[model samples]
Target: MLIDRYNSQLLMVDVQERLAPAIADIAGVEAQIAILLRTAREMAVPVIISEQYRKGLGGTLPSLAGLMPGVQPIEKMEFSCFANADLQAALSGNPGNATILCGIEAHVCVLQTALEMRAAGRLVFVVADAVGSRRPESRSVALDRMRMAGIDVVTTEMVLFEWLRSAAAPEFKPVSQLIR
Candidate 1:
């Protein structure tokens, strides 16, 4: 199924400072996430960001934080973001039924969150290239598990074009510039 922009929301998991450098190909993940964020903004998709134990991991990366000025990251101790009331409220408040996910330590937080969200009846899509773990094996396993649980594992570009849905879309030129 295609990702309809009007029914979708972006959920950025814990891409925190101290954890990011450890994730495999950190730069690649960040780059994909940047494109996702920029596209979300241009399309007016509501974004919900979460930070896991900000006191320890620190906040979301500075570059990502800058892209989302005035939007505070939901701080949570729960590994599964769905366990946190605030995050749940954010998801509940939004009109979106589809959630596009991006973040770190894919085996843990990202994995648990994806499974839970899918179980909760939300159509969840994990941006494969925009998610990572401290170890390549962990990431690989998480992606496989998420897919097994029926989550749509997707790439940033796939999502961008799916949301765009057409070359003639008003934001096409700007979104095209993003990938190039």
Candidate 2:
């Protein structure tokens, strides 16, 4: 299914300062996420960010956090964002039913969150290139598991183009420039 800009929200899981360094190819993941964030902003897609144990993990990376000024990151002890009341409340408040996910530790937080969101009957899409774990193997397994469970695993470009739909879209040029 195409990701309609008006019907979807972006959920960035724990891509914290302390946690990011441990993820494999995190720089690449972060780059992809940056593209998504830029596209989401241009398309007016709502964004929800979660930080697991802010005290320990620090906060979202300064570079990434800068991209989202004025947006508060929800703090949670729960691996799955759905399990945290605050995050759940934030998500519930949004009108969008489809969620685009990206973050660290694909096998843990990202994976669990995707599964739970799917279970809740919401359309969930995990941006594969924007998610990672400490071990490539772990990330691979998590992607496989999520796919087996019917979650739509996608890439940043796929989402960008899908949301744009056509060159006639006002956001097409700006969003297309993001990937270049």
Candidate 3:
């Protein structure tokens, strides 16, 4: 089934400054994340970003931070954002019942969160193009695990087009500009 915008929420997990620098495909991951963030903003999709541990990892890199709204992130100590109290509640609070996840350390944080969301019966989609880890193998494994667990694997433009729905939709022009 196509993921509808009304039922979708964007989750940016642990895209921290200290960690992103160590990831192998930092450039590719960041580019997709920027597109994800900008699309979220233009499409009016609700977004929540988590910082794993502010003191060490620092906040999500400065560039992504600037694109997001002023919502203070749900600071999490747990690898999975689902394990954190504030993040869990805020994610549950969003009207979009389906969640789209993207972040760093794909094998760990992204994997666990996708599993948890599946247990909670939410329609979860992981944008494979938008997630990464320090090693290519871990990212590959995480995607395999999530797919095995029944999570849908999607991409940045896949989401942009899905969320946009129809060319005549009002958000089409603005969001298309982001992809362009």
The candidate scoring highest on lDDT is 1
Task: Specify the poorest-scoring 10-residue window by lDDT in model 2.
Answer: 88-97
State the lDDT at 55 in candidate 3.
Answer: 98
Per-residue C-alpha lDDT of model 2 across residues 1-180, encoded as one tens digit per residue: 899888889999999999999888999999999999888878888999999999999999988888888779999999999999988888777545789999988999999999998888878999999999999999999999999999999999999999989999998888888888
lDDT of candidate model 3 versus the reference: 0.88
lDDT: the better of candidates 1 and 3: 1
RMSD of candidates 1 onward, in order: 0.9, 1.0, 1.2
- Which TM-score value belongs to model 1? 0.98
- TM-score per prediction, in order, is 0.98, 0.97, 0.96
RMSD of 2: 1.0
> Candidate 3 has which clashing residue pairs, if any?
none
Q: How many pairs in model 3 have backbone atoms within 3 A of each other, for residues 3 or more apart or on separate chains, i.e. clashes?
A: 0
* Angstrom error at residue 135, model 1: 0.4
Write one digit per residue (lDDT tens) for candidate 1, span 37-112: 9999999988999999999999899999899896789999999999999998898776447999999879999999
- How accurate locally, in lDDT, is each candidate? 0.93, 0.91, 0.88
lDDT of 2: 0.91
- Angstrom error of the Cα, residue 51, model 3: value is 0.6
Which residue pairs in candidate 1 collide? none
